[model samples]
Target: MKIRQLQFFFLAIFFVLILSGCGSSSATKEDKVIKIGATAGPYSDQVTEGIKPLLEDKGYDVEVVEYTDYVQPNLSLDQGDIDANVFQNSLYMKDFAETRGLDIIEAIKVPTAPIAIYSEKHDSIDDVEDGQSIATSNDPVNQARALAMLEDLGWIKLKEGVDPTKASEKDIAEYIKKVEIKPLEPAQLPRAMSDVDYSFVNGNFAISSGLKLNGAVYLEKTPPHYMIGVTVRESDEDAQFVKDIIEAYQSESFKKLNEEDEKYEGYVLPEWMN
Candidate 1:
């Protein structure tokens, strides 16, 4: 009788150990995987080449989800389909969140691509004829930026007291307009150059379309305008994994890759981690 009781107790203990082991295995699988989403171009390339290895070394399984459109990546992140995203800047993200009712926050400022104005009709700003049509982005923030660039170039004068953040063509006070401004979608700006006298193209679209940045008639000044960052849900703001991802992107290896990569040199800089 004593032997049988000991055997029963041992069986019960063994079953409890098996259940505990299963629970631990499930938790480990859940914690090890991290799904990151990014746009399909240079942004995705940078994360894969520059940041993935660091996370893998730290025992995290990093999976990069590639996207083409700007909207889907954030949507995926918000829905918990992705761990995080690194495509847009704070301005774009703010606009997206307000317009879409999202609760995302920036994780780190990575790099900024200078916006440029390209022209097939004119080699330089001096060559642009008075009354010629110049194309700019129609998106509100970018449109304001395009106008600011023009204002800086002495092409037009914005109204006094008009905040740079809230600038619009309607804000132009002077009637001495010599150029016809046409606003178009950011993607279409590059292709519209042949149709218009000049078109302002964002860096990503310009580079992807093979537009040369070096000889552009106008380019956004570097530094502050160069602020682009990774984004995550407000809940993940202080997560250790988020911090690790930021550190990895800001690593020396990644910085070197951004600085020395042939395609990256004139196109982007290594200004990671704000």
Candidate 2:
């Protein structure tokens, strides 16, 4: 009787071990995998450097897809090539979707990096001499932002009722300082700072060129609508994967990266995250 009882006990322990192994395999199989698409530079770095590890800790396999062009991230998301994208801000994405007919939607706002005007020759806008040259991006979107920054700086007055998003050089109603507007490629603006009286530099390009945000003579206060977000397909908005991404983004670790890292310097966190 004692020998039979011992054999039964050993058999039960063996069965339990097999069941535990099966459970572990099931959990591994259930791990969610998601891919995010973003442009090169800070946006990509935010994921690859920060969010990627956090999600991995939660058993998510995260893939960050990078694109150099502005158009393809939305196109890829719309076609299900990626689960999400983190490239353009809300306003630009809205304009891109309306024009391209892509059905992408903003899921959650990410940190903002604003357009800034830097002056190497002048301490302030008031110091700019009359008829001096100021350079801005030749691209229309950035040029519009540069114009808006100039208007806010009181250097020029845009036409009354001119939409800031669509404003152009022709929309300048008055030159407060008689400064000439020189449109140049955004990448060249950082280098052009020495050449022009003042240069409008996009945030990412500025950071890459070793320009510090603290050195800007003027920086635009980005509106909530101008903040970047995790853009996703309408169909995937309610998915648990989407929630996981947002949670990972809003984590304390993510905030710490912006606070402690030079790469994320001058990033403005979303109001909701605050």
Q: After superposition, how far is residue 233 of candidate 2 from its true place, in Å?
A: 2.0
Instruction: List, residue by residue over 116-230, the lDDT tens digit for candidate 1.
Output: 8888878888776678898988878788888887888888889988976558889987635589999987778888988998888877677767776786887787445435678
TM-score of each: 0.83, 0.79
lDDT of each residue in 1-274, candidate 2, tens digit only: 9999999999999999999999978866654778899866778888898889988888888899987566788998888778899877777787788888878789889886777789888898678778899999886777888888888878899999999988999999999879999998767888998888988877766766777787888777887766878999887778788888889888888888888897677777799767
For candidate 1, give the lDDT: 0.80
- Score candidate 2 by lDDT: 0.83
Residue range with the least summed lDDT across 10 consecutive positions in model 1:
265-274
Runs in model 2 with CA error above 4 Å? Answer: 1-31
Taking every candidate in turn, the Cα RMSD to the unseen true structure, in Å, is: 4.2, 8.5
